[model samples]
Target: METAEKPNHIGRKIGRIRELRGMKQETLAEELGISQQAISKIEQSEKIEEEKLEKIAKVLGVTKEGIENFSDEAIFNIIGNTVTNHDNSSLLCFQPNFNPIEKLVQVYEENKKLYERLLKVEQEKIAYLEKLMKEK
Candidate 1:
């Protein structure tokens, strides 16, 4: 009996790397000047164009080859090997302490605040312009 090998999906690799880097799709989309939906579509793709892949790699802070060669097992192995107790036993404390969703929400709140501030300034400018025009 022969088992078929699964294809290495470049898009999946890109998504994993981005997640590992603690990045959100919105952030990645903003960096690439693309829509969040576009980023979602790209992640769903099994294959991506080489030039576009290069640009994505740049935004992810990884080389294209690195994305192509990415493996979850390798990351776990590296983390497992690097961490150890004083007695020389390996400690498996691999879970991320911070929540990714929380980070994304914080960013969203910051952007909303900035947008509100800018809108207020624009409204004040318009009011000033209206007052000046009334005097004319």
Candidate 2:
């Protein structure tokens, strides 16, 4: 029998990544300014446009490439490698979860991008204010 997972199913990958981040469909919908049903449909899709994928990636705190390359096996491997039963020197397998340090670095990178975006907005506001001052 074939496995449930389909290769290069972008929508499924997005849904999994969202779940890994502890997000709900409703929450992701809100972040994307779309209806919850739309989010559901997206998760059911086999392909998504690159622009929409970029927006979703930004909201999910991951790179578009990351989402495109997501896999349950990769996650399991990461967790399986790190979590072990020291007493018996065997693997203590469980649900896949984040590596705190890796998550921190990812968050830091996202924050840096956010900061740059915010800085650009502030600079635009300043420019507008200066234009008003000059017009007065």
RMSD to the true structure for each prediction, in A, is: 14.4, 18.2
lDDT of each: 0.92, 0.94
Q: After superposition, how far is residue 17 of candidate 2 from its true place, in Å?
A: 0.9
Each prediction's TM-score versus the true structure: 0.61, 0.59
Number of colliding residue pairs in model 2:
0
Task: Give one digit per residue, the lDDT tens place, for model 1 in 1-136.
Answer: 9999778888899889999999999999999999999999999898999999999999999899998889998999999898765663434655678998999999999999999999999999999999999999
Ten contiguous residues with the weakest lDDT in model 1: 85-94
lDDT value, candidate 1, whole model: 0.92
Model 2 per-residue lDDT tens digits across residues 1-136: 8878666999999999999999999999999999999999999999999999999999999999999988999999999999775576344554358787888999999999999999999999999999999999
Please give the distance, in angstroms, between residue 23's alpha carbon in candidate 2 and its true position after superposition.
0.5
Q: Which stretches of candidate 1 lie over 4 Å from their true place?
A: 86-136
